[model samples]
Target: MLMGSCKSLKKVNTVSIRTTKPRKISPEAQNLYKRLQETTKKGYAFGHQDATAYGIGWKNDGTLFKTDVHEITGQHPAVHGFDIGHLELEWEYNLDTVPFALIQDQIKKIHQKGGIVTVSWHASNPISGEDSWNRRGKPIKKLLPGRRLHRTYKTWLATIASFFNDIKDDQGRPIPIIFRPFHEMNKPWFWWGKGKCSADEYKMLWRETVDLLTHEFSVDQLLFAYSPDAFDNREAYLEYYPGDDVVDILGMDLYQHWTAKSFSKNLNDGLKVIAQLGKEKQKLYALTESGLEKVRISDWWTKVIDQQLAHSGITWALFWRNARKSHHFVSYPGHKSATDFMHLAQKDYVLFLDDIVPIEVSSEAQ
Candidate 1:
């Protein structure tokens, strides 16, 4: 019992030592952080993962920019999510088969329209040479500074940094990105999950990644978000937290895996935890990834998601990708939940691209 108390006190001191400010951030990124902080007071932004790259049955062939969210409600999501899986291998396309060039183009377009872009990386395992889900061995230790895969991992980060550095605007200014890497670390499926590595190792991995991108590579137009899967308590949620200085956003990825009652209870509970932590740390919070698969519950948007977020103090809520009939999150035009989703979109507290005021930065800053 005494040892546990001592460790807890140490963690508290670590948290207190760090500041909430982003490290070496660009001017536009600073503006974005301020805007998101202020916008949270009014309402939470709505986000969709890979919304413009592809949809239920169509892929953007570099000609038209469309999303199921816009098709249903005539408004785009305020936040847009993209992934850079397989980027470490210097692949031309991500694991989702979306071209890297397309992702960059879409990011520029989103930034031009004053929408937020959040990116996640599902990097392949360096030890086993397998995909991210391969948890055959403890790879985190090997990916660290002195191990055999350390050089390989640094090369991967270099590629990622180059990609981030290339995502600039019309005037050649770096666009701000909410970079979410090693997400859902509380879950066991991924290689970097709870049982795969010790909490200290995870924290080190996060800190080193941020340090490399910000200080080593000079990619500063980023706001790092540390997101874990749902948890029953605050201790479990924060067990793998890197630090406030490294993380700009405190987020959780939740999904309605069971009954709506259970989902609502869990959402409410999780939001309370982050909200309190955000206040203590002076950091932004968000529902980083969430959805009810297939929209099986017709009123899920209005009754479950929106209801939970209604004064939840979250900065944004991002639904997962819209892949196909059996594997989609948001409602399409003719789906059963489409009308209910539209109703949710119309809420005064729900923000879409049309509802948000465009963030303006000086040309000199650019």
Candidate 2:
């Protein structure tokens, strides 16, 4: 059945495509996906981290295109024990006009290094820019606003699904890509947000996106993650939640505030809620987005994640940034950096490093 669309360009699936031509999924691939979905598995993350909003172009030039990617790759997870690496998406593949093929190779590199890659999407950004991913890095409002001539963004789903198929694993299985669209849903800062979108409206968009991506596009290997910023409380967290079935992975983005009392409470409360939710759903979980703003001490790292993982249903943690002081984005005070979180695995869950494969995470994270 065709999903409903908004009267104007405000329609949930609107997007500015690079080409007017449409693509098709081969019959064999379609059959493979249908069979795969049966055992496709739902993946989850524990203590994951996002690289958005981080400016690292040497001396703050913000041209971080090449330099920052390498730096982030080397340091962030090394300090943290992350199983996933999340990046933003763009109209082009990479620095060159290699299309989406090169991007798939890069994702495989991340996976070869023991982490799956994720590309993010926002509702507002529609214009294709010079950047390799994420509409050339333009804010969604600037790229698209107030509805346009074309009111649907459905084509993007097809584009990404095709990219996923082009990339495969050692066994020839398509590289399972984790696509996180419209993240930080509860945060009002995003253009799709701005404190708008009724629950039904949001759900409609989410469901439509999923239906087109999974059923229509046949990207069965993709994992959908619903990530919200740290909540003030559970009620705030559930406000933008897309519900359990629509989401394969449930995670949150949080940070270490400079303040002692406030940050501590936020961290503790957030972890407590994470544990509860993971157990309730029997899902794999993560502190999806995290880093320290100011605090910096080696022990601070292990303690923070260890405490959280020490809980009943917690899994791995991914810290961000490898630099000291200012670069404490994903690292904690005592943890030294994101890599520091890994050491605590033995002490925390002891079982998270438990099942180290994507298949296991997919099954458990669900």
Top candidate (lDDT): 1
- At residue 62, what lDDT does model 1 achieve? 85
Error of 2 at 330 (Å): 5.1
Q: How would you encode candidate 1's per-residue C-alpha lDDT over 184-246 as one tens digit per residue?
A: 999999999989988877887786787678777888889888899889999989999877667
- The worst-scoring run of ten residues by lDDT in candidate 1 lies at 1-10
lDDT of 2 at 120: 55
**Candidate 2 lDDT, 1-366, residue by residue in tens:** 011122222333444221111223333333323322321132223323233223233232223222232342332221112111121243443222223444555455545544445455543344542232333332333322233412335445555557667677676767655556776766666544535445444554565566566667666666566678778777776766655555655667776766545665777887677667756765545555666664364555456545544543433344454343455454332334535544543342232212233232222212
lDDT of 2: 0.46
Give residue 155's lDDT in candidate 2 (0 to 100).
49
User: Top model by TM-score, which number?
Assistant: 1
Off by over 4 Å in 1: 1-22, 359-366
